[model samples]
Target: MNASLLLSITPYFPRPISSRRQCPLTVRRNARLQSPLCLASSSAPIATRETEIELENRKFELLRAVTDIQRGLTATPDQRSSIEESLVGVETFDAGKPIELDLLDGTWRLQYTSAPDVLILFQSAATLPFFEVDQIFQKFECRDQSGQGVVRNVVRWSIPRLLEEQEGATLIVSAKFSVVSVRNIYLEFEEIAIQNINISEELQALIAPALLPRSFFSLQILQFIRSFKAQLPVRSSQRQSVGGLYYLSYLDKNMLLGRAVGGGGVFVFTRAQPFI
Candidate 1:
């Protein structure tokens, strides 16, 4: 029998070592065992190894399924169902206590999401001629050794009429996240701001040649844009009712899965370069 199968039926408690003579053939024939006579001690490691392999296979399938979904903007209903199924499979083997894992501290690139707000942005970018959306990232920085951290969702977008192709705007949604449970966190919205407007080289070169050098133009524009930040007000609270619940369904060295509580939506992310 397979080790994993043996583990399922094996006796939880170790049976006392017995000589064949101690267990008479007539007595053994009259008794029926609820579980296998074998002990489960050796099967534990085999079961764990099997689970790890299954998780890896599930993750690979999920990544492949979402490869062409364009962050879920173009995913059909059938495709969505398939992806959801795969997500559940991977989630079954989630880290027991993701908040306690140091692997959670890093920037993660958004590979796919079913959140309405994010999908709306993708739809808008596809339909609007002037507005375009780029990469999205979520950065986490834990602190105070309390399993608390700041989570920032960064969105890069551009307006073709106002900025060059390479120039873009960054929208940062800042929130404070606290571990409310082993796999759940409470996110309190803190602020939303648009910052870091990158001016393309072509535009800087063209405008700078006429009046000042490129470096001077770049510096002044950056200074002007730096003033465009604001501190938004937020209600203070640590209660789950005060904010939204984010369930970390899966997390590993390379990928992560975040599902909004109450079936709001799901987000899939892969580890990326740290945020500056």
Candidate 2:
């Protein structure tokens, strides 16, 4: 009877299965056993590992781009405007008060205000290394309250400066400004003089020669104000403080021009703000 059953099953078995197993009965029974489960589990882990690797690679690429920009700053001294354009994802914070910056190149000018009131001018080749306590010196042109021509000053301390200098010594090729006025012209119960100064067309034409370039002038003004506000402190009392104008100017080829403008105190807002 067993021989007869084997013959019957042999006809039903596939040729390859029968050849590999050599016994039809054994082959039929083994086909009902569970498939290998480990393969499925292993495949899942492999796929997950691949995904993680891809994500890590993406992060590395982003970091490399930042490093490239920083490296460019230290490598060479480049034009400030060119440097600003190259910093694709750079971030800015406050150090003390706001200051205005005006970058001038020939007849092209860019003006902007910064919140921290500290502007760093770096070449496109300098690498921004991570560190604590970055010492920054501010250099920009400004007009005193008397409206006499533009004078340059160097700012060394403020909330914005403290924050940036504490860690992450970055080189910035930009400008800054402050909102609060520094001069105290108002006397106790004294009437202030209101004078409307107008310039004739001939004078305006003559003054144009002293003006900075027009292209970067607006940009410089805006940048300066933004940086200055980041560093400026809010005072409780509203008093008529001394106000001045700050801007940036540079020479491209042989022409002179204006870059930016800010109306406020040049560098009188922060004395007690903490550094970051």
Candidate 3:
């Protein structure tokens, strides 16, 4: 990504997540790992069949409210507070470590986020008529039972005059995450990559299609646009790097709510396909 695009998109996780404090919340739980120390094996009563139904209904209501808010981009102060309260209410039933839940091992489409960094992109999309922000997705892939995983944050966008809607490129941020506690996860970003460029046919024919697949360069075309495909390091120093903390406040098979450790704001997501 070039400096301008990076300036607009890089803050998706510019700062490391801090795992300092824990918020009071709860949430309904289902699915369990086969371990003696796992919360699922506890003696506490699990959600009754009736309670499970109620939780599902409540999730549907919250989903509808979030949709109306346009993912928090257009939410009023009162509306944002109301949504936050509803999220907390639903989080009350959350039990056990969500990172250990099998339901979390998949892609979750970002439905809402109050994070200032992400909100900036939403604001930019509204003001810049030519620039468009498409779906934002987070995919988690765990390698073992150690509660460690890889998290990829994908932002799909396009410039209307330069690229087609479906042919827009993606800005991917790759990070390594580990379950720090019952509801907390620490993310250490590895690198950032900008890829999957699709130029219009007219432009492709004008330029060599061979190099267009990955990158393009020519003396004939001095270039009006700046394009890049490279992986850049995120950490400046490994020793002093503490990383960022993501608090998984509430999670279930369908719905998820997470709060950034240092007032980065809340994030709401729903399970989605494995790939974009």
Give the top-scoring candidate (TM-score).
Answer: 1
lDDT ranking from best candidate downward: 1, 3, 2
**Candidate 1 or 2, higher lDDT?**
1
| All-Cα superposition RMSD per candidate | 6.8, 25.1, 19.3
Error of 2 at 202 (Å): 49
Between candidates 1 and 2, the TM-score winner: 1
Candidate 3 lDDT, 1-276, residue by residue in tens: 223443364345454665864343311222222343544433223334446766777787777778866678999998788788778778877856455546677899999999998999889988999888888988888745477888898888888757658447788999989888988989988888877765565554556555555344552342433364768778655444337999998887788789999998999999897874
| RMSD of candidate 1 to true structure, Å | 6.8
Note the Cα lDDT for every prediction shown.
0.80, 0.30, 0.75
201-264, model 2: which lDDT tens digit per residue?
Answer: 3433343433665346555543453344322322225653333343322222222222223432
- Total backbone collisions, model 1: 0
